[model samples]
Target: MEEKCLNIESKVVHGHSMFDPLTGAITTPIYQSATFRHPGLYETTGYDYSRLQNPTREELEKTIASLENGKHGFAFSSGMAAITTLIKLFNPGEHIILSDDLYGGTYRICEEIYKRYGLEFEYVDTSSIDNLKAAIKSNTKGAFIETPTNPMMKVTDIREASKICKESGVLLIIDNTFLTPYFQRPLELGADVVVHSATKYLGGHNDTLCGLAVVNNDELAEEIKLIHKSEGAVVSPFDCYLIIRGIKTLAVRLERHEENAKLVAEFLKNHESVDKIYYTGDTDNPYYDVMKKQSSGFGAMISFTVKKVETVEKVLKSVKLITFAESLGGVESLITYPVVQTHGAIPEEIRNAIGVTDKLLRLSVGIENVNDIISDLNQALI
Candidate 1:
């Protein structure tokens, strides 16, 4: 054979290319110039401006598309920017349904910003296919979901949801942030589009901010591309370089993250202070089979409720090894209080109904030694 196919591990390590052809550099160089020069009249270099496209950013986009097994990829300045731009694909009167338990930022934008545009949003428990089917109407144009939803770890069946969406002429969009492509590929499982806060795992180090949308449909890809270029929320060439470097080690980092997370889940399960824990990897977890069927591995995020609501503040203030912070998917562990920090934008009533209460805490188990992480939690619980 002239060529051999590469596995996901190799595709990541050797993204798009092994070296830059122009300069023979190992890493893609940042094309920092905002505008490019032309050779002559009616003749133009492929890239005329950075706003439209940059060589570095283009490579990153292609890399992400390849990983997600999609036809096109668009990168934005941040995760929220990507979602906001994606909304432009629908008309003002188009209705969309979303998972009830999702990132507070997404909820805030749809309600506070996009509501006035005449787009109607229905919040439902998408973990159940019946709830999703019940919410669809004649005008329903799309369904957005976060599989193994934020804070709750509830898994949604992408294949089943895709079938329903296709039957109803609704486009299926999946926020694949938590599991990343290493663990789950939604498009491969039948999703029409996959979005990610690349800042989390694709950037890997929490050092860069990026949002990406990968689309399998040609028409959807073209529309998203138009909006991306016209709105100019594109990621910078330097940040693109950072994300490209981060993705190179994604396979190895995720392996360690999942290993530590499983151990942490076991520790919390037997702990006296914890009342209940949410882990996708748990054998008795209701959606464990769905995760097993759709994904290769359970992600590293874990959420649990404390016996006493007062313990929330104690743990938030007590952890020394694990930082009390907002963002996740970094090398260092982070403990988040969703009620106030991440999910505060969500209404209290909705928050309560979804189980993001004062007693609840979300943990992003990093690739640290399992013993150190558990010891920190053990002492913090005391």
Candidate 2:
């Protein structure tokens, strides 16, 4: 079913039923066998082995593809694995353009490993069309953007950037981990490929580590599928099952997350110890208009700065309800200091330039009562 044609809640509920009509089972079963039995030497039902392909994983892939409005979806061991596999499609010495503010792991992958293999990248302010235009080079093969970018929360104009890249014959890739398909559909906005760290929102509970890549182009999908098989980074059947189960509650969980986030953001904005709150729901936010145009919801992520590093430490240590944690997008609220937690890998100069400061804190609002979350922050700030 087309993403736009189906209700998101319905898609989440019935999109990936593993049991075919012949058996009529309620839940998808984990096909634990390593290899499927072939009828004859040359006969097959499109699956040969778990490593090459698994029935459980395929069902999950189909569900994700339907959700993201893409022709195909591939599951990987982790979000980085999905990214690495997609990048392998490009030849050595090919150039890539990326947003200046990105997940620290993405930055490290591009600078450390990709660079070592002759891949070149230029980091630019992709939130502006002019910056993207100026950054494009003859050798540029792909443009990667992270909207409401990590740590800084800078929203990129996906449609505008996709138009520019399409005209230049450059592949447009988006990291949709922050917003997820529940709030935003990058493919509908003209992105050629979308990637997510299923470890986050897609799996919701922070229990499983997985990644997914969805592509609209059939030819590109085949290439990625090939790389997935060759590289052997596919997610296991059990992880696939866990992710599929997690997705069933995505719609409801995201709604609660958004609601809680709005309340927490407002609380931080008025807090005496807070200096700034970076959230897309705030009309005064720099990327407010663009975010509104592209996403149905503003999402649950919030970044704010306290008075100083000392105060930051005090608040983190004092919080009772909100867990001081590294990863986000779980069922429980989490707090992180980006300068040392999420964006710590980036150099100090680069981190500061991208607005990842020592005083900055990120909150992943969970599906908990807003008062409990706020009360924890209140006591912590005091």
Candidate 3:
């Protein structure tokens, strides 16, 4: 239905539709049936069991694919499930290189799950192309990067990294959760595949757990699909519908999120209690130039270090409006201490090396009134 011609905002709001012909329902039905009925031995229409595929889920996948500018998209039960399926493409004893400041869950999955199976990984400061080049080995099969990386907000040069991977015969995979397709189109930046924790920004409301992986190549798309089916970490029809609803407002929500985040970062930068603020949006930030080159917006996430851990604790406890939580990219503002929360799984030595200190606070700014959010922070800091 000429989906490619539609803009991203329009696609988010009305990309795919599987409607009830009789009722003319605006929203897609759940299609909760376990399996579809076959009229004859040689059936024309493709409808199978819920495990293989669901009409509701298919619509959501297509919508996401269209939004991300990719050939295919696969939904999973959770972010980690989608990540595991992607990593499984590499055989045992193969190697993967990742950004040092990655999400703890992703680090755990690589170190604990993949390690037991003989897969190896090395964490490097991927913000520089030189660091990435130095870390590459003969066995390196993949490069998994989280630009504007978790807790630190460090931006990596995706285009340069993609070129390095291509030259080295390494697959470039990026976790586009922080910025989402609304702000950053990774495939357009030359990434082979892009993954998302739909439980975060893509879902927008923190209502359901889902993950998506969109691939630029058709073969890799099919491979991950096979791995997804074999592992059976598929998202439920109901959850897919919830995500579809959330995505309708993604563009608007992200716009507000970025605006709020910029205000918060500015507030922190001037605060006496703040030792440092790490936000890609800030012109003074080291990653700002690279971010401007790669992304349309600097995104909603911000990280900063207070004068001390005690100050961090007090600010978190004193906040009246923002919730102290682990997850980010929701409608409601969230503040988390990475050392004790998101990056807790990584060792202290490694965390410190990556600039995730005890006093560091990561804020996922929401689409709330800017003054109200700033006032809450000001009062908390005072």
Candidate 4:
């Protein structure tokens, strides 16, 4: 198939060159070295310090950029490192719009670390274009959006929001961690930048900590490169290799993840104990149509609420197959209480407004057998 016509599943396998040019190695080798020597005096081999670039890291970056349809890609030590680099791109006095239902760590860093530097953030429901438009201040430089948002599963129309951002001279930054490029390509939908906590789905097995940032334009790529280099937050060669290995199976894994999630969502929706369920796969969900229009799949993350806060504890303590823990998008199922886990850093008032209440529980439905997963949930709810 032509490169441009290749499907995402195909892209996942062949996005970057699959073999090493030097030795015909089928897998990209980890170029594990702190620095590379110049070919000769005043001549360069296109690599200097590992912090600036590495052969293994470059391959992963190029592959991610190809997968996202972006011009350039960068790798970071962690998701927060990528986010920190993004925040540094703006001046202290400028403002950025953020999703109210953002990840707790993102909120914590912005509130506790960046806010002290004179950077301002406005939390708004970006799912409603009108609310996003209203939140844009004169000094607003950009907007950070999370669709199928963390814990809440709120979906925002990236194309529509990007058009508004362009009109108002604001960059559109998307957290594409939940739905990897295999499912959604935010850059193709008009986002200027797409960031990911590759430690999640992109690292599929949950064995590595890596972050990625892809930009659609050269100027933004240059800007991020400076921050990535100067801040010394680049991903190590070995972690880059692991993330690359994870990317190879992403298509198949997500296919199973979504399939299992659909069955689980159906089970939860019918159960008497599940008072309210959040999953984009539900046709009646507020963002269902929008999600269908913008992406290929509903993703594996699901959040549901029980009738009482006490039931939440009962389910958490009772799960046998599903592990109650932090972090997600791995082969093993994880059930998290966002009120005390992922979204704990956000204040209570803000949390309640965004529906991260004590009665709510989030599930990272893994690529497990549907019946076994359902059985676990069935037993836990009792």
* TM-score attained by model 4: 0.98
User: lDDT tens digits, residues 1-382, model 2?
Assistant: 5455778788887765535544676577787878888989899988898889998899889899988888899999999999999788888889999899989998888888889989998999898899998888889999989997997898889999989998999999999998899889999999999999999998999899999999988899889988999889999999998999898889999999999999899999999999999999888899989988999998899999988678898998999889999888999999998888888779999988878888899999998899999999999997
Measured on C-alpha atoms, candidate 3 has an lDDT of 0.89
| RMSD (CA, Å), each prediction | 1.2, 1.4, 1.4, 1.0
Worst 10 residues of 4 by lDDT: 1-10
Which pairs clash inside model 2? Answer: none
lDDT of 4 at 317: 91
User: Once superposed on the true structure, which residue ranges of model 3 sit more than 4 Å away at CA?
Assistant: 18-24, 42-44
Task: Give me candidate 1's TM-score against the actual structure.
Answer: 0.98
lDDT of 1 by residue, 1-382 (tens): 1112667888788777667878999888988989999999878888899999999998888888888888798899999999998777788899999999999999999999999999999999999999999999999999999998998998999999999999999989999999999999999988988999999988999899999999988888889988899999999999999999999999999999999999999999999999999999999789999999999999899999999998998998899999999989998899999999999999999999999998999999999899999999999998
User: Which TM-score value belongs to model 2?
Assistant: 0.97
On the 0 to 100 scale, the lDDT of residue 157 in model 1 is: 98
Q: What is the lDDT of residue 197 in candidate 3?
A: 96
Model 1: residues >4 Å from true position, as ranges? 1-4
Cα-based lDDT at residue 41, candidate 2: 88
lDDT of 2 at 359: 86
Q: Estimate candidate 4's alpha-carbon lDDT, on a 0 to 1 scale.
A: 0.93
lDDT of each: 0.92, 0.89, 0.89, 0.93
Writing each residue's lDDT as its tens digit, candidate 3 over 252-287 gives 999999988888899999998899999999999998
Each model's TM-score, in the order given?
A: 0.98, 0.97, 0.97, 0.98
